[model samples]
Target: MSQVTDQLAQFVVFILDQERFALPVEQARGIERWRTPTRIPGTAAAIMGIINQRGVLLTAVDMRVILGMKPITPTRRSRFLLVHEQIDCAIAVDQVLDMLQLDLSLAEPTPHRGTVASRGLLPTPFGFATWLDLAALLGSINNG
Candidate 1:
């Protein structure tokens, strides 16, 4: 399929801390307000914890630490984005932004320096997106 066609379809756009981030819309199950996740002992610091969504266990990734941003302090403004990467995972974000058709031509490659495995693509032209590479992001997390 053409890149434009792919871009025009659905996508999940969210705020990771103060920065705006967009991933191909399909990766997310849905976006919702932040919930107090059940903390899992012995997990990596970036893996904040997990949450049970309608009987399914969802892992929550703390984007702030993952992206080298300041640690997130739970507050009334906290939000959770239900992202389904390999398994059902909930990504804690500052907020859920609106969804819109992204323009492929304007899309830029993710920078190679970010903590995110796929840092190449970023949103642009009032709409930006990066193809979601879940395994790469998760694998980068040190289990030990």
Candidate 2:
């Protein structure tokens, strides 16, 4: 149970294949139903290309490829986590599981499992989710 005074840390929990992963809610603008993007040339292998959402263009990134998983065709259950508004990016995910809220004061220091794409483990009621370092995961977009 949470008290009124407990500061909450919000995370967007999502799935890619069978593995669960998360990113801070603050890092994402919102989640959208997966949309097929127009492929672009001379871009990063993980970048699926650009998508138009509500008249705004977003660079669609395939999280599976970025995380070293096999890419699959998008399905009805797929989702997009919108991020980097200035650069207009959307992260493609298999599914969104939940919006987690944990007491910030009770948070534990995540171990250094050591992947540039991850911050570390995030304890959840169900289990641990791989906490993503969004900047590290997405930085290659601009740098590529």
Q: Please give each candidate's TM-score.
A: 0.79, 0.82
Clashing pairs in 1: 11-25, 12-25, 109-120, 109-121, 110-119, 110-120, 110-121, 111-119, 123-128, 124-128
Q: Give Cα distance to truth, residue 142, candidate 2, Å.
A: 5.6
Q: What does the lDDT read for residue 57 in candidate 1?
A: 81
TM-score of 1: 0.79
Residue 24 CA error for candidate 2 (Å)?
Answer: 1.0
Best by TM-score: 2
Clashing pairs in 2: none
- RMSD over all Cα atoms, model 2: 3.6
In Å, residue 72's CA in model 1 sits off its true spot by 1.9
- Residue 100 of model 2 has an lDDT of 86
lDDT value for candidate 2? 0.76
